[model samples]
Target: MVSTNPYNDFLKECQMALQNSIATLHLSIPAISFSLDAPPSPEFGELTSTISFEIGKKIKQQPRSLAKQIVSSIDVKDFPLMSAAKFAGTGYINFYANFAELSKITIDSTLALNDAYGHVQTEKPKNVIVEHTSANPISPINIGKARNPILGDALARILAARGHAVFRHFYIDDVGRQTAVVAYGYKKLGRPSLKEKPDHEIGLIYTLTSCIIEIIRLKLALEKQRNVSTEIKQKLQMQLEDWSSIAAELKGKHPRLFTELLEKISEDKDTENLINKLNQAYEAGEEEAKGLVREVCQLSLDGIKETLTNAEIFFDSWDWESEFTWNSDVTKTLKALKKTGYAFQEGPVLEFDADKVAEDYKLKHMLGIKDDHEIPSLTLTRADGTTLYTTRDIPYSLWKFRKADKVINVVGMEQKLPQQQLKLALWALGYANHAKNLTHFAHNLVTLPGYKMSSRRGRYITFDEVMKEAVKRAREEVEKRSPQLSKEEKERISRIVGIGALKYALIEVDPTKRVVFTWDRVINFERNSAPYIQYSYARSRSILRRVKETPKKFDYSLLTKPLEHDIIWELARYPEVFIISAENFKPNTIADHANLLADKFNSFYTAFPVIKAKPEALSEARLGLVKAVSIVLRNSLSLLGIIAPEKM
Candidate 1:
């Protein structure tokens, strides 16, 4: 076996052994590649191949004879990792591993490499960029929007581990009407000192200001409705009642904020026009507008960074969406697209001909869609000459490609269509290579049972609040489980356990599936949760701490049990699993593999003793296995941006 990739080396040796057998048998067969994989059961040895079955159909010979000849002619001496080659049933050759040598190589290599045990290096490393968590600057990040940063950070970590120059980024979507409305609300409320976290305070200001301004507009509309139809009047009346109720609710929760915003906003005669002017000025690079909006955004972002830091999610850059606009990147992008003849005027608004580009490029099937499937054109700007969200994203995408060979945007599943449009727009602008390298890492939403979150109504749970509650609950669990620990020790472990549980819950599910989050599922210590893996690691450390010395010359031959073999195989295959996870952009693969390893480790320790085994050599060998498992666990958790606690 190779030093680092023991399983992969075994696989390569299996193929070579087969070729050697065929050559010795004196059979002339054409060059054919065979797929070698683990058999259905462990009793069939380590790996099984059915290439003889395919060869039988092509050669029109007796497969049973061929199988017998190959097994009899195989020389086990040539492959040190193979103990024997057995011809199981018909047309099947199974190979058993030499566990003694395999175990020594796997465990020793694992301990030697330690932290970098499973980080297999890729031959072609890339300069990759990951942008995510571009939440609207109007409100604090809610639980539903929290998946982006966690997944994005994990992706960057995984790629970096695989020898890629990866960069994590957060795109601040503050160049839109949402930011304008929030800034307007902040200004109307006298830009008061924050009464809570900056994001929370800004959210309250935005919600109250929006609700009140809506009510005012509705009331004014109702006043001017003379001789209107009865049905129209009823609809208007219902709408006014809804806004009034929303305003009342806001006032009930924040009386001072509501009163302050109402008094200040009512003083402006044309509040809607003022907001539009602010939006236009902000996009046009006006000083007063930029100063006012950027101040509130920066404050809110500071609070956002605090929440992300608590979860150990950090970024290399925080790219402002407004900067692209101010630096003329958006203008240059628009002009470039226009020159490509894909940009056309649809009345007073501008539109990009996406379908025409797809048709011209003949990329419908290449895009995994049918030829008849029509793509709707993307709106570039409004009638008032203000750019849309995706229009601004075009320039931002170009900016990212300038600094990277590949760009991955971690966004929600709902934005799949818009992302497709963004890519098509890039291609239409003659950035075909950039479009090819771009990826939309789309993920589904996170939902708590019995709760529907709406940012506009301020009816959602904040990430900060969730982290605090998770930690508090974790502390209770820690106290119940280990009451003798010191307060500081318990506090430290609780933070690690709590934050790890939250992140695991978000990332364990497949990215295409919605996560139904609940505390019972997240903090469970007995199942496939982060706490389970962390506890298993802690238990391994506990055994080593009690022993207090490294074992000299562990007897690898003594590890003969099925559970030990299972663990050895898993530890050996970890590097391959990591490569699959990184190449496929799936963090859940690592999570899944970690849970399985933890399960097997627990089962082994439960059935076999590590420190109290009959002979000292056997005890030391088991300890070696335990240490290897612990190292892999710590590395896997680190890739997920999770901490492995030593005493949780």
Candidate 2:
């Protein structure tokens, strides 16, 4: 059978009817294409169009009169799914669906498509790359940075469903000063074996090492200020006091490790210079520096991989930031920028003239820069010839585009300026097409209630910790609900529900919105939560299993009640929802749709009895409806990186 979109069918009918109306009235049709929006309330109709108002103004006629004319020209009998077309609210034309026909079409299509009910393959597909969750390997993944991977994974899933060749990437930032600091601490401790998870162990060393280094640097500055002005001496004292407070805090958390690192670091007078040297050597491909940094980063990444695997997050490629530097990609990028007249020398450093490029290319609007706004030049290299992060990112962006038509960087909102600068650098280097195709999928931070997390201070909750807690909480709830289930079954159910709840909570909110994540909200089984929808699906399956009867034929006309109509309407619109969500890169739409669909299905379950219906035809139709809802709920959840559990 050929696949079809029921909503798209309705849209085509409306467009064709409007064209016919224009021909019948001998009126010139305006070139403006208007949208058909669903009415605010079901009482108004299923689909409402306000195009008559625009057309009326064009033809010098009143809107109400034009609407009546258009309504008169539409023969509702000619449409298969529409029952009537009428004018309402001054100029809006509302078209009501023929529920019996629509219900039949929806059920038939759903039963035929099964798992492929909502997804559609685009005729024109492009190779797309989604790079996200490139968090620094110094610490474990936390809830604050969890949004990037969740959103990126959902986008990759949706685009692949839409027939795009999607590639998921995690750009390992192992070449920066942060990694060097962690590696420095590890080496100072004689590369001790981790007594705990590698990430947690490495994080403690990083934070403790950072604290001691700051104290040393501040004390040295104070000693040098002994002969300076009193004002300068006072400023240096304030800085030293701040570091003293951080040192105290670190000592309280990890006293043994802090004391050891402090003794080891204090013995060396040039610890800061050593870290800087390690950073530069790593970038310059020094084997010793490369080996040590990679070893530390790999240990942290091993723990990260375990956490991601538990959460069902995986990547197609793990791109290393150091690879680009070592392969001369950064050097080639600098040479290209210099040849484009966009790169200039500022003393010993090189800077990209971002403001000049934005103005020269007239990219103010495209780059979200206002005419009165002043963007500063971006430094490409330091005085000592060390490249900046954004400078390396330019080459990485080009590398990503080499294999894909579009590249989306799922970075945080705080990095919007740098992402914009990366794109601008691409434009200045004469790769305007690559610049245009680059996407900055910026997302806001996640906040836990009453707690502020800081990775630098080793005060954040790791992703593994959150997942473990979610499962533990879910286990309690599962036991309370189904105490008779075997231990193995309960554990399995808890794992699925727990992971589903976390993934759902993360992706259900808009990317631009901040999520105050809490256990109460994540594991909610009542309203607007993953467990609620999963329970609904399980309930549907239970009903079908109990009946043990297959509906070889369904009499769709029997499903005419208001609740049935609601379910049918939503089921028919599932394909359209999938299309809009994928095309717009909005997974929240699918999440919202799943909740609404579950609500309708539950209402129908309460208001009507399928198995006890007096007429066998009605029972079969209701069974068909239940099956369709189950299929749709599962498909919708899958789009959001969630699994619809068979049993809750």
Q: What lDDT does each candidate get?
A: 0.87, 0.87
Q: What's the lDDT for residue 638 in model 2?
A: 89
Off-target runs (Cα >4 Å) in candidate 1 are 22-33, 60-69, 215-245, 450-452
Compute the lDDT of residue 189 as modeled in candidate 2: 95
Instruction: Give me the displacement of residue 456 in model 2, in angstroms.
Output: 1.0
For model 2, how does the per-residue alpha-carbon lDDT over 1-648 read when each residue is reduced to its tens digit?
234588777777776777777678876575856578899888877888888888888878888888899899899889888888899888988888888888888888888888888898888899999998887888888888888888888898999899999999999999888898999999999999998988878888888887788778888888898787788889879988977887898788778888898888878879989989999999999999999999999999988877788888889999999999999999999999999998999999999989899999999987778987877889999887889999999999999999999998998888989888898998988899999999998888787787657776666777788888889988999999989889998999898888888888888889998888776765566678888899999999888888867675788889989889889999989999999998888988999999999999999888899888868888888999999999999999888788887777
Predicted structure 1, TM vs. truth: 0.94
1-648 in candidate 1: lDDT tens per residue? 237788887887888988887777666467676678789999999999886776777788777777778888888888988898888788788998989888988898898899999999999999999888877776888888888888888888999999999999889989887788889988876677886899888887778877877787777777778567677777889998987887888889888878988998989998888888999999999999999999999888888888888889888999999998899988888888889999999999899989899999987776776799999999988887888899999999988998999999999989988998998998898899998999999998777797657677777778888888889989999999999999999999999998899889888999999877676666555689899999999998999899978675678999999999999999998998999999999999999999999999999989999999979889999999999999999999999999998898
